[model samples]
Each structure stands twice: as C-alpha cells, then as structure tokens.
Target: MASSSSNNTHGKNLRNAVVALLAPLPSIFFYLSFLRHYSAAAEAGSLSPLWTWCYHHPLLLANTLFFLNVNVLFWLIGVLQSSHWMIDLYWTMIPLLLIHYFSTHPLAQCNSWRSRLVILLTWVWSIRLTHSYFRREKWQWGAREDWRFSDMHQQYGQKWWWISFFAVYLAQQVFLMGICLPLYVVHSKDKQLNIWDLLASLVCLTGVTIAYFADTQLHNFVTRNERLKKLGQDLVPNLDEGLWQYSRHPNYFGEQLWWWGLVIFAWNLGCGWCFVGALVNSLCLAYVTILVEERMLKQQYRAEAYKNYRKRTSVWIPWFKTSLTGKEKET
Candidate 1:
C-alpha cells in the first residue's frame, strides 16, 4: 500500500512538472509571431491600411496581441489540467501588464501627474489582489481544481473542454479588456492633472484598501471556523462581523468602487465612450457575480444563517442596509 501510494504521488508530481513546462509555450509563440509579423509589415510598407492604422495605435495592437496570447494560453492550460479556473490568476495581472506597457511605451503621453498617479494606484491594486488570490487559491500545478470548475466539469462532461474556452476563458478576457479601457484612453492623450484626478486616485486607493481588509477578515474567520470544526465544534454558517457586517459582499462593493474610479478618471479626460467598460463591469458584478455567488452560498450552507445575513446586510453597497423583513434602511 505504501509503495502504491508513493507511486501515485510521483505520477502526480511528474504530470504537474510537465504541465508547468508546456504552459507558457503558447503565449511565447504568439508574442514572437506578433513581433515578426509587425516587423515584416513595417519593412514592406505594403501592409493593409487597417494593419498600418493598428501599428500607429500601439495600445490597440498590444491589447489585441496580449489578449490573444493570454486567451490561448488559458485555454491550453485548462485543456491540460481540465480546470477552467486556471484563467483566474491572470484576471488582475493582465490589466497591470497592459497599463505598464502603455505607460512606458514611446507613443504614450504618460508624463502627466494624473497618469502617474493612476498607474501607481493600479499597481497597488493589482499587487494586492494578485497576492490575495494566490494565497486564497493555494495554487500549485496539477492540484485539485476550484469547486465551481469541478461542478462544471461534472455537468458538461466531455464537451466542457471547448465550452469552457468560450464561456469562461474568452468571456473573462473580454471583461478584462473592457475594464482596462481607461488605461488606453489615459495613455492615448496628453492631459493635465485636475482635482477630479486626485479624487479618483483617492477613491481607487480607498477601494483597494477596503477590499483587502474585508478579504483578510473573511480569511481569518474561515481559518478559525475550520480549526474549530476539527475540534468537533460547530460554528455559524456565514461570517457577519467586521466588514462583513455592513455588507454581505463587501469585497464586491470595493471592486465596484475601484472600477468606477476608472470611469471618473476617463470622464475627466472628456471621453464619454470610456464609460462603457465600467458600466459593463458593474452589470457583470451586480448581476452575474453576486447572483451566482449568493446562490452557491445558499446551496452550500442550507441553514438559515446565510439567508438571514443576506436579508440584513446590503448586497453591494456597504452603507445602505437591509432589514430582516426585507425593508431597506440607511445604516
């Protein structure tokens, strides 16, 4: 039995190593192809007008290439691991990469105070969120997948491989690019910093901090609850203290605030179309994310604790509270 167990462990480790080695190939290949194609087109000067136009707009070209590379890589990884959540790690990282690329690009007008501040805040937010996700996921190559993805695998069976490419990976890629649109606008034009820019910066930072602390509190609660459970103790189904007390989804609220800050920054630049990204992000968070998450929580807990918490706490707004009887109130 011991020898068999050891053999199984070794097999799993070998599979993980292999997957890790091959995971980055798709992105590397796509990036090299993009550079070569771009260089050849520039030298020939016979490329189509559309390709020529894309070359002038570095952000557009970069966004398209980056998205294509990452999306393909994600699908490849998912196919290898049979886990759709593999794409989740890059959700925060992609925006930061795009912002950094454009900010440092020669074509970018990123020397203004507003641009610098926005870049700094974006870095902070991205780093915090990435760190949180890394720790929470306890990610390792060839490890057990997220429960949600596991459920999807069971539901879709064999067809899940291709279905997830579109439903999960590509859909998330679209959302990510949309949310990062403000960075494109910010780098495209040279604009002086204004008071609104400062306000937006503050709001963005505040949202990041709020989300960080809320996640921390929830993590601690879960840790304690698990420890107690191991000791044969029963705890409540949901955490409703600290930041969770004010809002059932405080982290989601903070996320909305952070995205809305981008909207404000773009609006300050006098571009109305930039609002589309934040608007779409808001709808996704409010409708898709929260609804699905709450439903999952209810199904998992089954007890009345989560239901009661939902009734009393604000769904997305922290300040606005709800009553047990389904009445709205200002907290």
Candidate 2:
C-alpha cells in the first residue's frame, strides 16, 4: 500500500512539473525564423555578394544579434534539462562564451525574405523541440545529455560542441540562405509552389503527424504501464504494436525524413551545393540516431524480446517487419 501511494505521488509530481515547463516555451518557437533579414538565395562562395553585402549592411545587425543569442538560448535549454543548477551554469556559459570567437565570421549577414523565412522555419522547429525536450524528459542535467548531444560530447567533448555551436550556426545560416537562395537570387521569384514545394510541404506535415502520434503512444504506454505496476499488475510484455514494428524509433525516423523534405525544397530551388548540406545533415543525423538510440536501449532494455526485435527490423526504412519466429517479410 505504501509503495503504491509513493508511485502515485511521483506520477502526479512529474505531470505537474512537465505542465509547468511547457506553458511558457511554445510561443517563441516560431519567432526565430521571422528575425532574419536576408534570403538563402544570395550565397556567394568567395564573399563576393552573399557575405560582402550583408556584413556591410547595417540593417542586418539584428540577424547578427540573433545568431549570437541562439547559442545562449541553447544553453538555457540545457539548464532546464539539468537537475543540478551548477552544472547548468557551467554548460550554459561555455557555449555562450564560445560564441565570441566565431561571431565575426563572414557569413553572418541578413539580406532577403527567403533567408528570413528559413530562419523562421528553423526557429519554429528548434523552439518546438526545446519544448518537447523539457516536457518529455524526467531528470535534470547529468542524467544524460540528450543522447544526440551525449554521443557527440563523448566522442568529441566540450571543445567540439564549442566549435560546433559557431561552425554549425555559420553553416546552417549559410544553408538556410542556400535553401532560400533560389527564392532570392532568381530574378523570377518562383514562390508560386511547384511539385517539390508540395512534396516538401507534405513531408513536413507527415513528420509533424508522426511525431505527435509517436509521442502520444509512448506517453500513453508509460502512463498506463506505470499505473498498472503501481496497482500490482504485471509489466507489459512488449511494445511491438504501433510505431514499434518497422523500427524501434518511429519519431527519430520521421525527424530524419522531415529534414530531407527541406533539402528537397532546396533542390527544387536550383541551389547547387546547398542541397548537399541537407543531404549530409540528414545522413549524419541518421547515424547519430542509430548509435545513440541503440546505446540507450542496450542500457535500459536488455531483454530477449528487444534482442529479437533488433534482429529483423530495419533501422529507418520500413522495408522489413519482424515476426515472433525471427523471420522478416520476404524482400
């Protein structure tokens, strides 16, 4: 009876804490995209037009400020996730301090509506994810960096995340401009929507849908199972039902695909190497997902059932399904 009461109390506390964290973070999720002054279309590789024009332009100061502040914001996100305040302070300030070293990069300019639009899109995505991170997780800092962050840190360390913060920002801003480059550079301004545009739109929508459902299902499973356990019921035998069939991580798969959708939109725009950024980014993310996710499952769920599931299902592609007999659908 006492144990059951304690579990109920824990669940209630977690629910309340998550709700408190979520209420304030969703509004600024979309604000970052709207702040940029240039479009992705103006990228000139040798600092010809893209870098020269924006850096000299006084109107783009906000864009510079935005880039600098994003690092700080990411640090704040780290704070909210960390259980300890001191660790939060250390992680948060390190990235923020590193920004000074790279704030003077040539690509840090603002120019067109397309650039602005892409910034808006990225901000919306980032903030949305930050919200999800705080609400979806239970422990504070040091519990585990988000596995994506953790693996990179373990593999690389603070210096890399530092280099990563600025290098990644410059590159993303560059890529953001590239994706929107066609919109800005092309004299025609083909904003009227084409097949690739439609596909990109659909891909993003599909991702949102999958993320929503996957999150819901996982949350329900945890809630229901926790409740059952508290009531002296047995643990669930398997989670091989909904999004668990094709791959263990439906949400991560959707996330990887969704970014590719952005790349496709960039491709249709006639941007050259910019699409390469998206492609490479997607591929790298897939590798991260596979490594970190498997590491986590290995730590938390070293069950025979999971071992069996791992044997047959493909990682990201839904090409195969695993049966209890260890056979997959015939290719």
User: Number of the top candidate by lDDT?
Assistant: 1
Cα deviation of 69 in candidate 2 (Å)?
Answer: 2.5
Candidate with best TM-score: 1
Q: Which ten residues in a row have the lowest lDDT in candidate 2?
A: 83-92
Query: lDDT of candidate 2?
Result: 0.49
Across 110-211, the per-residue lDDT of candidate 2 in tens digits comes to: 234444444444444454454455455543323334444444555665465455455334444444433333322222233444566667667766775676
lDDT of 1 by residue, 106-154 (tens): 4577547767788888999999897777667554444556566677778
Each prediction's whole-model lDDT (CA): 0.73, 0.49
Relative to the true structure, candidate 1 reaches a TM of 0.82
Q: What is the Å distance of residue 123 in model 2 from its true position?
A: 8.4
How many collisions per candidate? Answer: 0, 16
**Model 1 bad stretches (over 4 Å):** 1-54, 139-146, 289-302, 320-331
